[model samples]
Target: MFAGDSDLSLTSIDLFCGAGGLTLGLENAGFLSVMGLDTNRDAMATYRKAFPDAEAVEGSIAGYDFGQWRGVDLVAGGPPCQPFSNGGKRLAAKDNRDMIPEFARAVNTIMPRAFIMENVAGLLAPRNREYMAEILSLFSDRYTILPPRLINAADYGVPQKRMRIVLIGLLKGSIDFPAPTHLPGRYVTSGSVLRRGETQGYSNPSKIVYARRPDLRPSPYAGQLFNGGGRAINLDLPAPTILASAGGNKTHFIDELHAVIPYHKHLWDGGKPRSGELEGGRRITILESAMLQTFPTEMEFAGSRSSQYTQIGNAVPPRLAEVIGASVARALN
Candidate 1:
């Protein structure tokens, strides 16, 4: 397990702080999270439950006072990424959900020794390049911002192939991104964290819909196997990104008999199951999703089932965050 220097305890304030994923990771790295801020009531409840000692404040980041948090060693968050998410409208800067500017505002006001901003990889697309440049310009004068890097959660042992863009800014010194602990051939697989036959309470699709589009064909690596947004998961490999839209029919499905059925082949003898026929696969449960996201087994999420799924899906993957936090702690120490 990665451990930070126990002698030097750093501090941080999580801005978006959904369910305390980043906060949990940083705490594991020996940083004390003093406060967490967010707007979702359910997320705040989860965050509070996870970090009871830390103040969990519910409110929008916009117009919120960050000056009070001045001198915090680090200010970190994954701002709302709906604007740049591939699953969303891809509105870029035009979307009302865009919160990069608010994140920059918090960093500038807090003037922390360093700041880490996480967002979807789509932010780097050519269409959003100019908007991203504008967002970075907000911090150029105050901090030494590193070139944004796209990081894969699987590289850090998270059992999901989640990719995100991370931007680190330092006030004085340089810090390198954490090196991948697990390589391609040895990546931690879904089977490492997820258990078999744990689908008791979770719902499965009524009828399985196979992808007819050639472009959606399942590949050796990843692809859409079903018609819904859910992707097929290979037990021996990292699962595809667990989306925020889970807890519904769109949630990714797993087939214990994948080796037998394989790819797009039907479970029945000749064709797709009739309408209302129970699909022979199971969608992952809330606890299973949290486990796949690398949350502690004891971690309890508050709020509705949908909200819990969203919190888990939107989290930074505590394992990945811990790796990043360790790097940051090393730089600070």
Candidate 2:
């Protein structure tokens, strides 16, 4: 936790708050989360449950009034990123789902002492650069916008290699981005949080579509044996980015033996699974996914299995958020 004067305390409001990941982190960092806002029913339910003292409002951010929260010490959120996501159409401001402008509008209206916004790295893609410039202009009159930084959750001790762009703006104070707490070879690994023996009631992949075993590559990031967006996990290293599209064949696979099987052409000489060949593996469970995202073990997600996965995948790792929140709190103090 970032220490401040004896009476230093700050209040925050989280917009686009899905399942309260940022709220949880800020709370852990000594900020009082006064309110949360989101459109997903299940996500709002989870947020309300997690932070019962805070008011969790359910609605779209477009045209939402921030008049009542005019003096919140911090305003933070991850607006819908589908429009600027690499996997999406990249419509940017043209896409109806693009909520960056709304986020800016909220910041300008509330005029918080400081604000933090996180989104997919694709937001800085060449195609969306112009649109991003326009959004930054919205805060020029009131806040000093810091250079956006591409941050990896693993650098902050999250067990996944998820990366996102983080932007910070301050109305009248100076703040720096949080420094990495862990280095490359010292990263926390997925194996440290997951175990093969703990897969009792968790779901498994409908089918194992191994194109082939891992090749004799020199890099620790080499083994990608699955067919969909998912890949084979290197237990010794951080897991690949967890996707919101979980509970399907695209979900990441784990080698039960904890060994990366060597490439064997005969295993699938024709690019299809052999009739008599088999391997020991299973898709990661929702709980495991949450663990990888660095969510608290006892935090209950209120939704269907798929909705729960979406909540976990979409969350900013609470650990990473706490680091950022500490920095913001120090600036405020």
Candidate 3:
């Protein structure tokens, strides 16, 4: 396992480990990742590249053996959450992709001292209260289940307003939720991200063509923030949630001039929104998305563009994960 000066002896195994975001954060905060598991070959490949010392395995969680991870210090993951995503069919536990039961089983088998599972806030919607109760009951007896807290990435120094429900359970005792490290109005803003100018593939021909298209009209398919109807990103503040499916019209950048910019622009702010001028509404690049998730700017992503975006968007922000990890470290020590 990757060891550090902190000499943290605790080890962890990550289930559904997409691109190693949680693993990276936990490692930064002292827990070494012994293994990372996921079914997505490309994402697992990227995880391997990022964490050369850790084992990255590909398989369905239900069929995988938890025996190898038994006696580990912690088990951490964010299971496939499409069933609980607001953008998806809210099937809750009925969605075959729902992996909470499998996760619960793994935790039971591994019998780790603690575990942290993250998912969309929609999982706790009133309609899914019973499902939430059932899942919590699985750990309540042997573990002190901390209240599932809604954690916003922006509150932890990430550049986006993404919110995920974090459930931390300890074998014995309780964990205090990490306090918000950043307050409103002090967040990293979209405008700042735009100014960086270092994102890969930012100048692709196709993207430039789409971004400069002056004839595109607003449609329902567009994200509300980009459709010129709902709220646009407050560029001076943190961005709205960056989506896994962001493309074309789904999300747009609004500039200081009150003009709607698509993700296909040549210049970052679409060049002052002038009529008959080359316009800007280019999509946020993969690197920018990763930044919003607070991945180190120098971190390497080894996947296709779409796969990279999926991994970045689906990840638990490393900033937030570090906070959780530090808390876990304190509680464990």
Candidate 4:
């Protein structure tokens, strides 16, 4: 499919391509993925199983040669977000895990006709404004850097309200981002996709029940960060951002409802009424997280349950990626 360097048909590679989410979207948008790279073995295993044709490289991006990718039409991937994640330490450039420098090096060395970088919106928050400016300056001389846009996955038909920042750079011209395909009130909900049971060709996911600790108080952020409702999911609305955390603070959905009790009932009742305390509330299964992230049901993912959850949480929702991919593809044309 990627027979030429022509804008309409382009060859691409994905760096930090955990579980192939970004590559999948780019593939759907007509860019042929030449290869994919990541350091995590389990994630690479999942990527290889999913896209056997795309050569998978398992290693760090640092010290890697980019010369082989010289003719690549596009380079796309998000650097790790832990350094700037609000749920994280917010270390910015100080964190040893910050990969933005390597990302810039790849784009600079590959000199692709176009590129797309995605990250948590926290990178653009006021605290990291200087770092954001530094990242943009890296391409100021060559690529026509489009304004960094904070995009909502729900706006593009994903079933969750994930707010991500995207930066698109082109060698010659600019491209407008894809407009929202759905309205706010009409956005898809978590229940709409999660209510169904296991289907053919998909893994059957068991529900996880939340256990309350008497010593701890209910997390006020039981729902999505932007929404302040208790942990029980408002099944009628889009899900909160799927977190990468493996902790007690992660968002949970209410699987079953109990008789209405005081807001702090769970706090004193030793975690009773906690999210997942009843039949309906619990931590989301890996499959459920994938669905919320807009991955296809039939697509197979490999890894332990927790490992798979990490992979899914870190992925760019394919629906959102598809939208961005199409926009990038249009600019190439």
lDDT of 4 by residue, 1-333 (tens): 333646456788999999988998898888888899999999999999888988899999999999878878889999999999887899999999998899889999889989899999999999999989998987647898888998888999888888999998998787787789888999988778766333223332334443443223454334222112224455677877777653233535444443223434545454444454234344456667788888887767777766777788889988888888888888887
After superposition, candidate 4 runs with Cα above 4 Å error: 1-8, 196-230, 246-251, 258-276
Off by over 4 Å in 3: 1-7, 196-201, 204-232, 251-258, 261-278
Q: Tell me the tens digit of each residue's lDDT in model 1 across 1-333.
A: 012323467889998998999999999987888899999899999999889888889999999988778778889999999999988999987898989888998888888888899999999989988988998998748698888999899999999999999999988888888889999989999988665665634454434455555233336334544556665577889988988888776677766555324433543334443333225566777887898999988889999888888999989998988999889888887
Q: Candidate 3 lDDT, tens digit per residue, 68-130? A: 677787889999889988889999888999999999999998888899998999988899999
| Cα error, candidate 3, residue 70 (Å) | 1.3
- In model 4, residue pairs whose N, Cα or C atoms come closer than 3 Å (at least 3 residues apart or on different chains), thus clashing, are 210-276, 254-280, 255-280, 255-281, 256-280, 276-281, 276-282
TM-score of each: 0.90, 0.90, 0.83, 0.84
Q: Which has the greatest lDDT?
A: 2
**lDDT ranking from best to worst?**
2, 1, 4, 3
Pitting candidate 2 against candidate 4, the one with the higher TM-score is 2
Candidate 4 residue 129 Cα shift, in angstroms, is: 0.9
TM-score of 2: 0.90
